[model samples]
Target: MIPSTTASAAALELASAYQSPSLQSHSHRVFIWAAAYAREHDIAYDAELLFVAAMLHDIGLVPEFDNHTLSFEEAAGHIARVFATGAGWPAARRDRLAEVIVRHMWPEVDATTDPEGHLISRAAALDIAGKNPDDFTPAFRAEVLAKHPRLNLVEEFLTCFKSQATRKPTSSAARAINSNLDSRMLTNPLDAN
Candidate 1:
């Protein structure tokens, strides 16, 4: 059987092809932001794994999906079989991550209690909120702004994502996450997201 890491790597690599360039860049920015949030809160994360996971969280956004909005449940279900057979993730671990992935969507899953879950959930939310340059089509932006008059922070967060999307990852930040694993952050295995 292929090792879990190797399997995950393959899945992530395959996932890249299906993502839009804009979505891909935004995904990276989202992961990095989530990582930053995790660090600030001193949550223990498998940074390398989380980075890869974050990068591919929306792998199910196939070009075929109209509007390209993949539900968390669908994404999780798609990933579970792929990870289980190809990556050999332990059954328990697979179940846990799958639940987290499926419920990662807003109004469905809450990540406030678990550090990693929060990172994944918020990162996806920020992406869906579409505050990025590529994401902001004139009509969509206008609609979104009007629809979410109170979500200024999310709008601001997208602005940051838009600006930073073009920048390279910070060397120090990457290094820090790579080295630290003792964050001891809480993880709710049963939480939906």
Candidate 2:
């Protein structure tokens, strides 16, 4: 079964309230992709934790929470940590989840050091940029996307990242926006044929 818990549900609720419909859909796709990848590769992962991480990964992009002082990843990590703490997650697990959220913005993550983090990072990369689009079977990708359609994700993400980069030019989001916004926005992963 897809991993879920009270904590994960709460995270999803928070995200749904604050995030756009497109972003919420994207977040769900991230979880689906991560879980599917873990299953296909025979990699063990905590579904509940991955669910929470994927759902709240973009919480910092929410306008009410975005202060433009910290990087979006850092802000999102802080939000997730607070939620995890209130949900009675132990420090170690909470920290791991936070790391997963923060590291999702990395250009690449080493799976050896933090498998969950790496999975989420790669999943977000796949959803946002279509990186390694062929890593999974075409049917698997189709199933995930069918459940959580893109909803014009490329334009939505570009708009979000551009706003963040414009507001916080020194942040990692800005760096990423400057470097990858063009390619990512232009290329549609679902269009692979």
Error of 2 at 156 (Å): 1.7
> In angstroms, what RMSD does candidate 2 have relative to the true structure?
1.6
lDDT, model 1, position 55: 54
lDDT of the structure predicted as candidate 1: 0.46
Q: Which candidate comes out best when scored by TM-score?
A: 2
- How high is the lDDT of residue 15 in model 2? 88
Error of 1 at 140 (Å): 26
Q: Estimate, for each residue in 1-109, the C-alpha lDDT of model 1 and write its tens digit.
A: 1124665466556556665555555555556656655666677766644655565565544334212233433554456545655566767655655555554543334
Q: Put down candidate 2 lDDT per residue, 79-192, tens digits, no spaces.
A: 899899999999998898889999998878877777778889988888887788888888888887777888777787788788888989998778977787668757856755
Residue pairs with backbone overlap in model 2? none
